[model samples]
Target chain A: MRIAAQAVLYAAFVAVIGYFSTSPAYVHLAPGEAVVKLSLSHAGERKEPCRTRSEAELAKLAPNMRSPTVCTRERVPVRIVVAIDGTTIFDVVAQPTGLAKDGASTVYRRLTVAAGRHRIRAELADAPGGRMTYSATTEVDLAPGRLLVIDFAPEAGGFVFRS
Target chain B: MRAALAASLDACEAAFDRAFGQAGNPWRHLGSLAFLLVVVTTATGIVVYAVYDTSVGGAYRSVRAMSAGPPAGLALARSVHRYASDALVLTMIAHLAREWLRGHAAGFRWFSWLSGVPLVALVYASGIGGYWLPFDRLAQLSLTATTEWLDALPLFGEPLARNFVSPASVPDRLLSLLVFLHIGIPLALLAFIGVHLLRLTRPRSFPPATIAAATCAALVVLALMHPARALAEADFGSEPMTVAFDWPYLFIHALQYRTSPQLLWAAAGAAGLVLAVLPWIERTPHAPAACVDLANCNGCGRCFADCPYAAITLVARSDGRHLPRQAEVDPRRCASCGICAGACPSSTPFRSGSDLATGIDLPQAPIRALRASLDRALETLAPRPAIVVFGCASGVEVASVREPGTAPIELVCIAMLPPSFVEYALRAGADGVMVSGCREGDCAYRLGHEILRARLEGSREPRLRARVSRARVRTFWGARADARSLSAAVAAFRRDLAASPRAAGPSMPPKRREALDA
Candidate 1:
């Protein structure tokens, strides 16, 4: 009889834990909408003026430290602006990678957007004059639960869209 | 201060044992239960992993879909997985505390204790990794706090905390890494558990069926009642306010709110070092391991089968003998409880001969010497109805049981007494025998008291004979500090023997004694 009671109690305990663990009150959420992924990689060539060292200046420096020509190695930061339906959604100054800040600047992002027909505009500038070094305007039809990718190809000289 | 702390912990353990130490109780199998819980957690975790989404954007949504719109059992699986993980930590802590309180954490037992320290850290790491699988508010909070902690170290070139600055900064590949760690840490933990039990000849890897069942049932009930669910979707741009925490595995994160991360790491590291070196800190003297006498061995393999530590093995005898096998003792694994000697049939005190030796015996205190001691103890007794008190060296000091007509005998462990020795004592004119050892769930030699109890109750082999009077034998269990209580128990047993009607003559019939002597 004592064993039977323990069995009953054990069964009840198991039942209680099982009931609570899978209690069917969890909220059901909708599936995520379409996403727009952007990938950009650009590096502007250094345009700083170079000067040749005079023999007198070279003689004043340490023998190992002498250089014939010197120019600024600082890279121009890539400025990008992304717009959807005439409204700017992304604006950033992407700096180059590496310790000397003279490498290519890269950008990767995924943005969620509602399914619809939309006009997309993107611009990038590599110099300090604020002139658009690269720009594109395109029409896109997005479907629910789909992905739209926008990428940059320097050889193509502009942005490319793939679905 | 350390001595006081150890005493306080011992007192607490004694109180806990008093409350829960019943025969066939689950509390007695905490280590086994912890292993069982780990198995349950792994099984349920596999089921959850089958449907889990690895991508950061889909991880949270996939969990929701699996929980609410599943093949129905996945929701239950997730809940069971979480609860079992929590239960595993709980049982592991209880098992560690029980071992510590029983004073079994040092000396020769240090290998098992030290191996267990890493197992705890691995369990915590694996459990926290599970939380990071679903990219929700809780995961973000865990990741933020963890990276912040790691940032305190000089090992990383860039602070890992920078990855959580925005959703754009974190990538889906990082979620994959979390999944890998979640799976990898447990595999490492399983390996450590194997190493921990390597020294023991026969480790109890799983608890008894009833205990395993009851523990599973309780976990299932908890899972069903309070199913684990992801909170709001993680927004790396926003601060996580009012994050819910699972205290068992995440209590350390709470310290982040009050103290510097470096200080928390220092405290945790110091605590871990203390636990790892505890065995060395408390160096109690242990009896040398038992040795096997090949000449006296009959090649029966009784000691090999009965050795609790699995330290004995039946090997083919190199020397020619009628019987094929002989027992070999492994010194590294032997606990030196002399249980193997007790199990040897040649250990019977009835075998009369000077310079007696058993097939397997302790080098420090051999069975022949034990017999001589028992004989001397019996000789010192006053008269018939005189009591023989058998006590363990690890338990209540037998010297404190100063009853008028009782003779006290100490053994490495009370289980070292062969059952026939009790009958021999009775036949030698003692009225009754009382045995005592470390309290239940507190045996210094792990299963010593349990094995003794089984032998006395006539359930296990080498059991006390049916011919022996049940009323003439009593067993009392208590710790070394419970010497006064043991004395009272011995006095009460003497009174009970005095009140009972005395046997007419010798305990064994004359005809039976004559046949046995032949």
Candidate 2:
């Protein structure tokens, strides 16, 4: 009888394992991307394009952040606002805006995507030469799409884009 | 010194049996199962760590590499870790529930209640730490969420997460410390498990092989389907992460992220703590046998001997009256198994107040109820020769003795059977309904079977030249190993069922399963 009871328990253990293995596990990333909007209302005409920000960028954008990283391009101070599509993905270091040409001090962040072509864009939140916004958008092929975004400008104050 | 030590050891071993040999000691078995899982987790954790890297960038990639690397021990190790954890949880819940159900948690056993809370906490902490090692996007996110949550507590001034999130700000040493804590906590759990079993007299180690096999198989399936991977290499400042459920631990994260964090934590924590203390808090009014009057106490240590828990102590008193020894009941260990009442002498004025036999009596109403219950259960059995065997819950395995062709029935308690029901079965031409019970004083349900047996035995009355009885119910006590006893009782009942004149009286309707399944 004892042996039989042991056998029954052993069978139950096996069945339990079989049950769990077949069940799917739910997975999610923290500080994941969420679409947001930045309204640029000139003369009460609002052109608010949706932008996305990584959590770190949001923190720097936060009112209380101290000593946020700054990105410099061609010896010019540039603070760029990163946006996926039209949404601001991140606000550059210490409220940095625009792009930089110098690769050093470029702000890069990682994002995960499903396998497919994804549009990644970096636009100038605030730039020199009359609020110039040097913007770039491109479709990159990704398998379980993952990429690092690096936005640049010639200097901290200047940019190439006219719009 | 050696001789004295051996003598003490021998004496302790003897006392161990005396203390824990009774029923409801399965907690000892639960402790053993917990120990095995701890061992598996430690052994597997070491192997994963040897090839593991703590470098901020390398941590995630290293885990992925290990998962994809030599499939040798990795699969087995992962399965063992996963399933053993599941098994650990299952055993803990079962052990905890059983204690509550048996009312062992009430009274002085509250220490087991308090210590159990920490064990549960440790399970969650260590389980979360395991997911962090995977270093996938999900792992990264989990770390962020957990650390951020931890930082919410006043324990840490600044966000504790800041130490691990940024590239330069976060150090490998801090990451290593997290890893150390992760590995160390299970060891702490092991220590707690030791303390958990210390009070238990007999510790049963190793779960039955089937349970282990089921646990292993389920884990293997999980590992295969998900194939533990790093969703993406760990990069500081990366907000987008892929997260997967750890099932046990992830549910908390899921609840927090999807709903309100404070609410989830508060509700879950409170509910879990309450459940942990429930066994201790619940007080069921057992039959009158539980109450003992000191004045009615007899010198005979019958109650002391009958108690499954060593709750009763026979104290020698110098009172000059009728009794020399009085049975003192301890609120601490007394499970209230009232065998002492039956053993008390009838002539003594202070016989045991508990009448286990009275509770066992099958009055007419309960007998009809038992009949209805049997009718309901038999609806699933084939319309062939079926013997309904109603054994005490603890003696359920006795149903295995039913002849290959016979079907068995289950009941909550054997005392629910009335004498008329057995006569009704005989009148219906059905086979006997045998009520198998646990050994005399070992009933987990406290004298349930003893009462029923006494009622049946007491019904025996003599007639002219022969003894005639209305109900031909056969009652037997089943010892744990007495397969022979089980067989003899069933065999006798089977012969009686076959030989009875009512064998072909009425045919039972076809059971419902065939039509339902079809």
Interface RMSD, candidates in the order listed: 9.9, 10.5
Candidate 1 - chain A - TM: 0.68
Q: Write the residue-wise lDDT of candidate 1 on B1-518 in tens digits.
A: 65676677667556545434434355567888889988999999998899888988888998887677543388888888888887787779878976886677887788899999999999999988988888887788788778878867755544576576566769868888999999999999999999999777567899877678777877766666667776789876545545566767776776754667889899989989999999988888766889888788987877776676677889888678878889988777788988888878788877656566888899988987887876777656875568899999998999888556788889988888889889888887788889998877556677778788889899976789998898889998888778988888877887888899466544554554454445
Where does the lowest 10-residue lDDT sum fall in candidate 2 chain B? B459-468
Off by over 4 Å in 1: A1-163, B1-21, B24-27, B66-76, B151-162, B256-265, B315-323, B457-461, B481-504, B507-518
Tens digits of per-residue lDDT for model 2 on B185-247?
Answer: 988987887676554333344554543444445555555554544456555444543444555
Candidate whose TM-score is highest: 1
Q: Candidate 2 overall Cα lDDT vs. reference?
A: 0.51
Clashes of each: 16, 44
- For model 1, how does the per-residue alpha-carbon lDDT over A3-62 read when each residue is reduced to its tens digit? 665566555545543443334322111243555666566775553556899999999999
lDDT of model 2 at residue A127? Answer: 29
